[model samples]
Target chain A: MDFSSKLLENAVYEMSQLPGIGKRTALRLVLHLLKQPKEQTERLSNALLNLRSEIKFCENCHNISDVAVCEICANPKRDRSLVCVVEDIRDVMAIENTSQYKGLYHVLGGKISPMEGIGPQDLTIGSLVDKARKGEVKEFIFALSSTMEGDTTNFYIYKQLKGLDINTSTIARGIAVGDELEYADEVTLGRSILNRIPFEGSLKAN
Target chain B: MDFSSKLLENAVYEMSQLPGIGKRTALRLVLHLLKQPKEQTERLSNALLNLRSEIKFCENCHNISDVAVCEICANPKRDRSLVCVVEDIRDVMAIENTSQYKGLYHVLGGKISPMEGIGPQDLTIGSLVDKARKGEVKEFIFALSSTMEGDTTNFYIYKQLKGLDINTSTIARGIAVGDELEYADEVTLGRSILNRIPFEGSLKAN
Candidate 1:
C-alpha cells in the first residue's frame, strides 16, 4: 500500500534523489533513521543543513574549507609549486590517501562534456588559470580521469597555460605493478609502451 | 591530513557510522552532497530533522505512523483479527508489498536474542501477550525469518500462547520454487522433506 504520512513520504522521496539510491532503498534508509533516537537523527540533520552554509570554497586552491583557504593551501610543508588539478574534492581525498604526492590541489568542479552541455566555462578552469598566472606554481599536474571528457578538459586547461613557462604533466596510464602482461588491456599496454622507461640490462636500443 | 573543517569531519564521522560505510565512502558521500544545489541539500537536511519530530509509533499496532494509530490499524477492511506478527517494520513493508496478505500486522521491534542482551522484557512481547489475552484476534501468524534467533523467538511465543484457543501458525519451511535439488543445502533439503505435502500421483508409493 501507499505510505500514509506525507512528511515521511517526502523524506523518502528526497533520499531517493541521491546518487546510487532507489525508492525502495530510500524507504529503508528513512525508516532506519526514523527508528533512531531524536538526538542522533537531529545531529545528522543539523550537520547536513549547515554543510554548505558553514563551509566555503577555498580562495586559493578551490578545495572545500570552513575558512577562506583550505588546509592544504594554507599548509607550509606542502609543495605549492606542484599543483594537482582534479574534478572534485573526492579526488583530492583519494590522492591524499595514497600519501605519495606532497603537492597542493585544484578542484575543477566538473569535466568538459559537450553532450551534457558542461563546457570549460562551466568549470573552475578560469580561476585555475588565474592561480597558475600568479607565478607561484611551477608544474600543473593533470590528474583528471582517463575518460574522453576528462582528456578534453585536460587539453583545454593545458592550452590555457601553454604560453607560460609552467610545465604540464598527466598521471600515468598503464598496467599496475605486479600485474600479468597477458591480462593487460590494449589501451594500458599501448600507453606503457609509448611511455616506456629503460628495462633492466637492456642495452640502450638503437 | 585531518579534515579541513570540523563540521565536515563530524559529517564524515556520522556517515561512516552507517552499516557497510567507511571513512573513505563517507567522505565521497559528503562531498557529493556538498556539490549538489543549496536547495536540494536544504531539503535533505530538513527531511532528516523533521523525521523524528513528525513521526510517532502507533500505540495499537506498534507500526511507525504520524498518528496515535497507524493507517493499517485504523483501516476497517483489513483483517484485524488475523494479525501477522513480525520482528520489525521492514517485515511489515515486505508483507505489504506482497498484497496477498490482507491481515493487519504487529511489529515486535526485534526478535529474542539473549546473547545480544535482548530479552522478551526488553521487547514489546508483554503488549503482544496482553493483546492475545483480550480474545479479539482469531489467529496469530508468526511471519519471522528462518534464522536461529527467529526459531527461538517463534518457539518461545508458541509456548506462551499454548493454552489459548486462538489458532497459531508459523510460516512454512520447504523447498522454494526454481530451486535445484542438487544445489539445495542439506539442512534446507532435510527441512523440505520433513515438511513435505502428500503426493498427488496414484503410483506415488515406492
Candidate 2:
C-alpha cells in the first residue's frame, strides 16, 4: 500500500515483520499508536528495547530471567533432581500457573523441526545432557508437545542419556480433563487405553 | 499468566495494549521477537519511535504526510474545488488507490462518536467549514463509512455549511461490487433501488 509519510511506511514495515501481523494489520496498529498519546509509544519502544538488551536467560535451564539464575531454578523448594524438559519459557509459564509441578525446568528453546532448519544442536539439549552426565538430575520428564518435532527432540535427548543412570519418562497424553470421550482424537484415545493407569492411583492423584 | 522475566512481562503488557491483541497473543509475539535477532527488535522500536516523534500531517487536508502539504493536495492536476471528506489517512489512501476521483481530500481525523466520547471539536470540521466559507471548495463528497457516527458527522458538517454556496453530497449506499443481490442487506438494497442511477450513466463511468 502507498503511504503518504515515509515514517509511517517504515513503522508499518517493521511491525509487519512480526510473526502473525500482516501489512494491513500493521498499518492499523501503527495508526492506532499515532492516535494515542505520545508517551504510550515511548513506553512501548523503551520496553521492547530494554527487553532485548537487558534480558537474561538462566544458566541452569535457559529460561528467560532478570538475573543470572531464574527464580524457579534458584528456589530451594523446587525439586532440583526432577527436571521437566519443554519447548520454551511460555511452556514454563503454563506449567508454573498450574501450581502442581514443583520440579525445575529445562527450556529447550524450541523443538527439532528440520522443516524450519531448527535441529537438535539449535536447542539446549547439550546442556541438559551435561547435567544428566554429571549425575545432577535423578528423573527427567519429557513434557514436550505430542507433535512429530516434539517427539524427535524428546527421542534425541533420551538417546543422549542412554548410559546415564537417569529415569526418563514422558507426560501422559489422553482426552483433556473436560473434553468428551467421543471428541478425543484416534491416536490419543488409543494411547489412553493402552497406557491405562490404575483407577485408585488416578483417584489418589486427584 | 506468570512471566519468568519482568522485561518479558512489560513488553507483553505494552504489546497487548494494541487493539485486538490479548495477553496470550502478546506473549506469543514477544517470544517470537526474542527468538529473532536482536537487531530486528531494535529496528522495530526505532521505527516506531521515529514515526511517532517526527511524522507530520498535511496542513491543507489534515492527512498524515512527511511535508507541510500532502502530494494529492499539492498536485495541480487534482481539482482543488472538489474535496472528498474522509475519516482518516487510511481512507485517503483507499480513495487514492481507486484513481477514479480527481478531487482533493479533507481528512476529519475521526468520526464524531458520543459512545467513544469523541466530539466534532475533536475533529477537523471547523477548518473544512472555514474553507467552504472562503469559497475555496465548490463541492464536498462525504465518503465516510455507513455508520451512525459517519451519518452524524456528515449531517453536522452539512449544517455547518448550510449558508455556503457549496454543493454537499454523500457516497452512494449500495451493494458492493461483485456481491450477489440476494445476499445484500435490506437497508443497502432498499437504498440502492430508491436512489438508482441511470444504466447509461453507470456504464459510462465504468
Best by lDDT: 2
Clashing pairs in 1: none
Instruction: Give the DockQ-based CAPRI class for model 1.
Output: medium
Worst 10 residues of 1 chain A by lDDT: A197-206
Estimate candidate 1's alpha-carbon lDDT, on a 0 to 1 scale: 0.83
Total backbone clashes of candidate 1, pairs 3 or more residues apart or in separate chains: 0
State the lDDT of candidate 1 residue by residue for A1-206, as single tens digits: 36757778888898778776778777877777776677877777778777767888899878788889888888899999999999887788789988788999998988999998998888999998998889999998999999999999999998899888899999888788789999999989999999887675335422
lDDT of 2 at B154: 95
Query: After TM-score superposition, what is the CA distance of residue A183 in candidate 2 from its true location, in Å?
Result: 1.4
Best by TM-score: 2
A63-117: candidate 2 lDDT, tens digit per residue: 9999999999899999889999999887898889888899999999999999999
lDDT (C-alpha) at residue B59 in model 1 = 92
lDDT of 2 by residue, B28-63 (tens): 898898889999999999999999999998999999
lDDT of 1 by residue, B1-206 (tens): 46767889888887676555678877877888887787888898788778778778789878878889988999899987898889877788787877778888888888899788889886777788888999999999999998988888888888888888789888777667778899988998999889777677414522
**Weakest lDDT window of 10 consecutive positions for candidate 1 chain B:** B197-206
